[model samples]
Target: MTFQSTTSGIWIPLITPFKAGELDESSLRRLVKHYSSIGLRGFVLAATTGEGQTLDDAELERLASVCADETSHCSCEMPIYLGVSGSDPRKVEKRFQQTKHWPIDGYLISGPNYLRPSQDGVKRHYEFLAGSTERPIMIYNIPYRTGVNVLNETMLELAALPNIVGLKDCCGSPEQSYDLLRCAPKDFSVLTGEDPFFYNAMVHGAKGAILTGAHVLAHVHLEICEDLHNGHQKLALEKWNRVVHIPRLLFVEPSPAPVKHWLWRQGLIDSPEVRLPMLPIGDSLAGKIDAAVNLQGGTDWRI
Candidate 1:
């Protein structure tokens, strides 16, 4: 089946909702249903925002099934992309083979973590994956998390492969990100994974954003993308101003913790449970989030 391409617009790197140390299937369903009604274009499951590191294969499978099932009932097109990351090329390949047949449309894969391969090694790593599967793969160039930067030159080489579609760019350097956006192939996408970079990225010709903040304010995020897409820079910047201080609060602690806490407080999810090594937000951050939530009287905050 040919799934729709999610190369543009406000896509959510969805937060995995858990309750009492278990995957909350009901909340997962609710999230898909709710976000679909909003203007957000796509959903990325079990990724950085979804707490992919802590989940087991069984749970990952279940998460894909539930998200795909829920999205199936929506009137809008919400492509479900599963996240795959590892330090070893062979293991990542095996991992993709494990879940390739699941209900997801494609994979959001990161460069090898920790080992920090050279540009050549990164090139070969993605080359191997693109050759190993016909599934659409979005390169996740998050140098801070993955420890290796997939440079623009190497990325162009990988982008030549038919199945290696686009990128979730968190390369961390504004110069590098802008250069990639300017130099990337026409069919290749450069969607900023950094929520705070949305306006700037769009200004620099980024196709769109895959932001975690959209999980809380999809309408706000989507309006930003729409304005920019329609050449309404003033309106886009105005809408983006409302979110200038958001990423700081959302990422005050470790990610998804603060995002999960905000969702929990809004009653969108059952609990703000995060895995060990990834704790829930503390009182100070919680108080800040509460104040933000109180600003707009719910999840639709202007903060």
Candidate 2:
């Protein structure tokens, strides 16, 4: 199957909704409907924002299947991408091979987390993964998480690979992003995984954003990108202003926690449950998240 980038609008990295230490299929279904109704371009399951680290293989497969099932059930053909990454490049590539037959649209592979490979290593890592699978690959270069940055030249080199399609740029450096916009191939996508930079990224030629905030405000954030893309600069600016502070709040504690908190309040999930090594969000952070959710009017905020 040929997979093209759905290179515009809000692409929500879904949170794993759990119950009794098991995947909550019902809540998963509810979230699918909720986002689709609100006009999300697509859904990304089992990504960083989806709490992929805590899930088992059974759970991962179930998550992907449920998303595929729910999207079709709603008569919404939103594309679904699954996150595939790990510390070892070989292990990551093995996992990617495992998903070769899964019912997903694409793979969002982040750079190795702990090893912090050099630029040559980063390029070689992706080159290996890209060659291992025929699936379209979206490189996730989150230096904050990975401990190393995939620089522009390396990215352009990877972009030339036959299977490597684009990137989810969370380098947290606008300078790198600007350089990428100036240097990357026209077909190579440079979506901002950094929500705070979404508007600026769009203005500087980002294809779109794969944002954590999209879990809460999918429609508005997507519209912000779309408006900017379609030359509706004034309206895009207004929308951007409304959600500008969200990234800070969401990251105040750590990812998926604040996002899960918001989803819990909306009744989309059972608990704001995070696995060990990542405890439940603290009261202080929860309060701030609650305030933001309330401020945005409980997931029904007008874009």
Candidate 3:
């Protein structure tokens, strides 16, 4: 399927589940089934939320294939997008070529991290990768993480490429986001990666979001998008006000830690175990997540 068709809606950046220090295939399958049943438009496997950096190529490919198979069997047949990143253009290109046979619909490729390449270099890097893949590519512009931002001018230039279909806009600059939203081609989608800014971004013309926080209260986030699409401005703002604290709570201890804890509590996964360098949520945050879930009317509070 084309990227434009999958760009506009709530896309979950799935968390990698581990059991006894290995990929939890059962939990991963169950998670995909649950989310796909809930009206999610697509899935982004092994992204930052999925701990892509910590996973080996084989693990990443396995994760993608599992998600793709599960999604295809679901009632919705959701598209699965893989997340890939690297500092060396040659290595990144080669990796993409090697993984070309993986069962995925597209890729969410981030800019090089640490190297902090110039705009021209960033453009060249993306262009070279785009040239290597037949599948659609979504530019992941999270400057805070990558240490380099894909400026609006560079974004527009990339948008002109036939296969560079959209962006996961976590640039962290409202000015840059708004400019790209206004100037990007209609087919060049702009989906927010910032959970806190999901509502605001959609209101300002972002097609959708790839929020990690949605792993808990997903329907509430999906409803926010639905409300805006149906032109319920007042209702959308009200919903946004009610659930805006979710992102803060989820990020209180750094990503999927808090999210994984919540999912485990909901009986969606077996354990909340994350890899080394990333710890599980603490007791205090666990209480907060519990209270948050309760306040939202418990697990039954879904659309």
Candidate structures ordered by lDDT, highest first: 3, 1, 2
Compared with the true structure, model 1 gives a TM-score of 0.95
Query: lDDT per model, in order?
Result: 0.85, 0.80, 0.87
Evaluation by lDDT, superior candidate among 1 and 3:
3
Please give the ranking of all candidate structures by TM-score, highest first, separated by commas.
3, 1, 2
RMSD of each: 2.6, 2.7, 2.1
The residue pairs that clash in candidate 1, if any, are none
Better of 2 and 3 by TM-score: 3
lDDT of 3 at 60: 85
lDDT-wise, the better of 1 and 2 is 1
Candidate 2 regions with alpha-carbon error over 4 angstroms: 299-303
- The weakest ten consecutive residues by lDDT in model 2 span 1-10
lDDT score, residue 153, model 1?
A: 93
TM-score of each: 0.95, 0.92, 0.96
TM-score of decoy 3? 0.96
